[model samples]
Target: MNPLTVLRDSLYFFQRNLSQIVTLCLPLVIVEAILQRIVDDAVGPDASAGFGLIVGLLVYPLYTAALILFLDARSRGESPRNRELLAQAVNLWPRFALLSAISTLLIVLGLSMFFIPGIFLTVVLAFSEYRLVLRGEAPLAAMKSSFNLSRGHFWRIFVCILAVLGPLMLLKEFSYSLFSKDDNTLLSLVLDSANSFLQLFVSVVLFRLFMLISDKSDQ
Candidate 1:
């Protein structure tokens, strides 16, 4: 699919299952909020807090993959129990966690050299969780698969992600500009909350895209 069409379909899918999506993501949202607060308190306005926050943000993708796996199974007319889904997800956690750590390290290392490589790594690994969840691949294999899947489609996927993510980011910036206090902490919190919600939404959309891409590839 073209970028715009992918975005349109993703948004439509999200809206169609909004209630179920929200219900699945609520726990992750709460956990993200708490982690944000903790990271903020621990780092206290330092630049390193951004890195810590990014590390914490990895949790959402893992949870999102689990949710998408469960939802997709149901969508395909499979009778998947929530507990069974959660167990399967948890079983994969160690591998996922290791891959996430490696990915984060690579991104950070690349960014330390310059920023471009970091962005490249981010795009390449974008489909790792989806690959792992959907195809039952090992973490490194999934990462490699995601990289290959995204190779020729880099710009397309990048544009699609930005289309969904850019507006939410702009809104957060505007809110902070309008309502930021002298202290900045409250504004930071508000922006973080907005970002968390947007990330959750994007995760769901991306999962749908992964499914679509996989189907097309199969055909």
Candidate 2:
């Protein structure tokens, strides 16, 4: 599974399913961005970043779990309704949110140690969400399985993630420079929502990798 092939396939899937994805996930993404803006305004510039992470924890798992379910449905040649996906996602939210929190904490801790360990943890723990959401593994168990599953495949997964996020990071900076949030609240909101929505592509790529690796490992 070359990174390029994985990216190409993922992009194709993302493009083909763009409308469905937008319909299924964009509203919650926008809500998250709006809540973030509210928190920023409420706390002012000196607020701890953890407040923003709290906003994310409130909404991120809902749409993320829904998207993962949508991806799985499409893979199996099924077309599930948005409400159905959202309902199922709601049910998964408690565990998924806890899983997200733990994963974020571990990544952040690893990042505090010279940065490289965090990157390594990021690659290795990539599939934990899928294991939890799709395979019904508990949070810690899923993380353990993902660590074991990612062995010898670190570079492949890391490269794909970098390729997808690198350009996004640059574009986000550029957009912020061009349209200062203080000057244009509406535009800033649009930019924030768009950026978060596009980041879903990374999810698509990782889901693709997860499926491929799991299938191979099963053989």
The Cα error of candidate 1 at residue 119, in Å, is 2.0
The best candidate in terms of TM-score: 2
lDDT of 1 at 22: 59
Clashes by residue pair, model 2: none
1-219 per-residue lDDT for model 2 (tens digits): 999999999999999999999999999999999999999999998999899879999999999999999999999999999999999999999999999999998899999999998999999999999999999999999999999999989999999999999999999999899888999889989999999999999999999999999999999
Q: Return the lDDT, model 1, position 71.
A: 61
lDDT of each: 0.71, 0.96
* Model 1: lowest-lDDT 10 consecutive positions: 180-189
Deviation in Å, model 2, residue 13 alpha carbon: 0.5
The CA lDDT at 119 in model 1 is 76
